[model samples]
Target: MIAINNLTFEIGARALYDEANWHIKPGEKIGLIGANGTGKTTLLKLIVGDYKPTSGTISKSKELTIGYLNQDLLSYASDKSILHVAMEAFDRQNQLHTEIETLLKKLETDYSEDLLNKLSDKQQEFEALDGYNIEYKAHEILAGLGFSDVDQERKLSTFSGGWRMRVMLAKILLQAPDILLLDEPTNHLDLPSIQWLEDYLKNFEGAIVIVSHDRWFLDKVINRTVESRKGKLTVYAGNYTFYLEEKSLREEIQRGEFKNQQAKIKQEERLIERFRAKASKAKMAQSRIKMLDKMERVDDVDDDNPSVNFNFKFTKQSGRHVINIENLGKSYPNLEILDHANAVIEKGDKIALIGANGRGKSTLLRIIAGADKTFTGKSDTGYNVTQTFFAQHQLESLHLESEILQELQTFAPKHTDTELRSILGSFLFTGDDVFKKIKVLSGGEKSRVALAKALTADANFLILDEPTNHLDMQSVNILIQALQQYEGTFIAVSHDRYFLDNIANKIWYIEDHKIKEYPGTYAEYEEWQNKRKLQPKTAAPAPQPKKEEKKPVVQQPTEDKSKQLKKLNQDLGRMEQQISDLEKEVKQLETKLADDSIYSNANKLKETNSAYQQKQSALKQVQQQWETLAEQIMELEA
Candidate 1:
């Protein structure tokens, strides 16, 4: 639907895109990815025509309509209600409807052929556009984006910036443009809202290009990846996971080629240097020198795989029981954040706490971690259970004058200077980077520092609030791996599904002022969510009539009874087959887990265990049902 030809964009002395050529196909869901400051957002703006390229042309079909959700700045009147702003997307249809109404009224008064014809045309136009259901569609989109019923009627001024962004997202979804451009679309979305969006975009009938830092979200939503790196664009044919593997493979090939070319050039230079010392071979040496000069120089391959090392070691181990909470309750004057919250943490449960935004997911985390104690219930820690909390407001604790190395030492005073430096290096802080003041670090860098400090606390239980907020995909994956291997308990509030799916053993869903635990993987939770959405909230179906009771009578087997028994046996056999299949799958997963190679990586092992658990659960349920049918068949046989 859109094409870029030799596009070049430069800012100050840096080139964002140079001679970039790319195409956006119809109905393509493209994920735009790159390191921070690599100009992923800038490329989106160029496609949307917000910024003109330095050279070359960006062309789009004349009839194509584009909707862009930019993160830079959004404009909305504070006094306008949320609903009012969202409804503006359907202004054209609304105006058409209004015109039709006016023309109908005129037709009724004039009773002329011209007026009647005009009214007929206007009515046809309105119906053709499906104008009647515009209001309902708008409301549905708003609610799907996490706006409550009351929020729709509230003035925009009362909402925060995040809500305003949601309002903008609602409008864009309602508009249903030909091309959708979104930048950091999931930044403000909670788990439920993000899930809703994934479903919506999967069915969206248009080309979509989104810039998001959440690798898990992108992997779920986009089928293709478009990366802007250095000053060029590279396209990958699969999702974020596939992109990671493909990028690594491509870089390895490039590195090999570069190395071979460098070796050949050096060998030629050495040969020419030796030959030049002999008078008789001077001509040959000169010819070789010319050949060397004519050789096309191979550019040094960039560091294709920049590895980040984060080694977190605690100073001391904690007691067996890490954190304990009992009937925790917190309430404002009129609003209750949490009521009678209760949970317990042993030594090594990796828990993911999830809920809609503002439902107190963070509040519960803070309460258990002892950062906030203004609660009605009791919170107790086991003996010597040290705790470290990585809060959403972690940036506030950073000191401006402290270097990265000094900051680590400050958090972990018992560690030697060499130990502190080693820890800093593991988190990608090295040489001059270690000397940079805390205040000078970017938001992402500061988040890494905060995480490093938390890890160095030697706490048996860690409470992390959005720990992956500013980290890249690799960094997030590394953290997930580390947490999975750590011999401690973890309670974290995060919206990253892949991270949660890979690491968490249990999910604590906070909803309707209550917390509920579910024993399953994220895929199972998604399946449950889909089933819930499919189910209607109607009154329960009327109970079936009870079967008539038969009088006890001794009799010989009849032909009809024999046929019934045969059919029941057949059904029981089918159920047994299903149970057997499930058991086989579970056994296969178990075998994979037992393999030494697969178990070497903590993350892979965790994923395998989760799959094994799910398969086992399925097998148990299937076996139970199968046994029940078998019993029924046996009774009939008797």
Candidate 2:
């Protein structure tokens, strides 16, 4: 447990926190939520004792171990592999293991009984600490964080900064400290990796406080939210969804109270003014005026809304067929990226392309955008298909010397200076921010500016690769809203689940060396996945014994008993096979349903759905037969 009392932190003239009091209870999952510059990260530093508060005391139990993961501070040495870095969490265990090994060597060299006993005790302690399984545990954590088997052996220098953050997260998880402080933990994770992390955190025994702009991740992980706003911290006892609802409700109540107080003050002032004009009620008037003046006025709430609006107005419309890909293939010598892929995109289609980190989602986007032509694919843009490709590396590709506004102006020539500034303002760049050089911008700021430029291009078809990367929740929501309202076709690869849920009508799952399409929302995809997981596997039934040949046979009415027995066995076999086949078919249909391409093909999907229904009906019939056969088999065995 950690407690902060009368915390007041100031940097120069700005007071980041004023008499702020907060406590993180044991086993609490708290999400630190706030705007870009609201001191969320600073508060984490305060809690971790990295920064001394200007005035206040931060108290914690001496026995409590704290682990803090700052995204920016995470780095890996060039020579170290991902697995090696992750294994650093078990340094103490490794040391103990080495000592145990040394003791074992000593025991074999005619050591005394007492010395052997000491060594035995040491081995017991090491085993109790799970020293033997440390390597396996470390590998599991790394793999869950998205490290491939090959990546585990590769040098740390081979990975990018984002992947380096994942290594840090893996280390933190493996450490298993009493308290965990995570800053943008999900920034480097893809959808599957994020899901894995959510499961990990859900089962984590330690207290967790995370600073993340990922709303959906927060909703799934954190149970409480601490919002930093206007130099103060407000705690809400719930997840992100509850926080949003409660915050809105509180704001409405505050607004009502403020209005009522204002009305009362106005009425009192009017009465005082009228009484002041008359000599007879001068004392009453003076008293009323004093009461009115003495009343404390409520401070105006800070405007949470961004000042500028982002309105992307395109100049032209694309043809019905926005983009067409025919036998698209890419390879790097021995490595094949995309193989014989074909897709036809239409206008007004909001498609989300998803896969693991090394999958060909980005490569496919590039081929469609015409950024890469060395592939064997013929990507043809329809007539009037003005396209803009927002690459993942767009921020790094910007000219460092140009100012933020200047960069936008250069890319979007049709936009006036005023229009460009407004767009930048909506993305949280304003006044002096617009004048800041592109090189000086933070990763998040640079990403926003790149997105602004991409949106301003007036493209009918937008191919964006991880557009939500480095963006805060508000900025991401703004982009989602804009994309949802846009009349153009969109093909984007993003890890933000909430963004995809809001903006995408279909999803293209790039897995198993192929692009599969799925219709419906992300929620539907999850439901489909859960159903498949819950489905029972097909298992071979236990063999039955043949009918015994007895010496004494009871004479019963003449009936075709042999024929009946044969028919029963055949029926049972057919029922079992039918159920097994239905299970397999259902899995395949669910997989096809989750595919975006299959959903896009209406006729094929309709047929698949019809077949799926027929399978379900057949499964019901087989299930009835199975129950009957099971009873019959039990009776016969008896």
**Relative to the true structure, how large is the alpha-carbon lDDT of every model?**
0.79, 0.82
Per-residue error (Å), model 2, residue 441: 3.0
Candidate with top TM-score is: 2
Error of 2 at 299 (Å): 3.3
What's model 1's overall lDDT?
A: 0.79
Which residue pairs show collisions in model 2? 517-595, 517-596, 517-597, 518-594, 518-595, 518-596
Candidate 2 lDDT over residue span 204-251, tens digit each? 999999999888899999999999988878999999999989988988
Give the lowest summed-lDDT range of ten residues in model 2: 550-559
| Candidate 1 per-residue C-alpha lDDT over 1-638 given as tens digits, one digit per residue, 9 for 90 to 100 | 78899999999877888899899999999999887788888888788778999998999999999989986545565688888888888867888888887887776778888888887787788788888888788789899999878889999878888889899899888899998999999988998899889889999999899899787789889999988887888999999889989988988887888899899988988988898999998999999888888988766667533343445555556543466565678977867887876555656778888878888888788778777878897777754567788975878889989998888887788888877776666566767888899988888889888887888777777889999887776567657766866777788888988888888887788765656565566666667666665655553554444457353232223566878887886786577467546655765775687589986798988898998889777867876786577556634533
TM-scores of the candidates in the order shown: 0.79, 0.81
Error of 1 at 64 (Å): 1.8
Candidate 1 RMSD to the real structure: 11.8
Error at 204, model 2, angstroms: 0.8
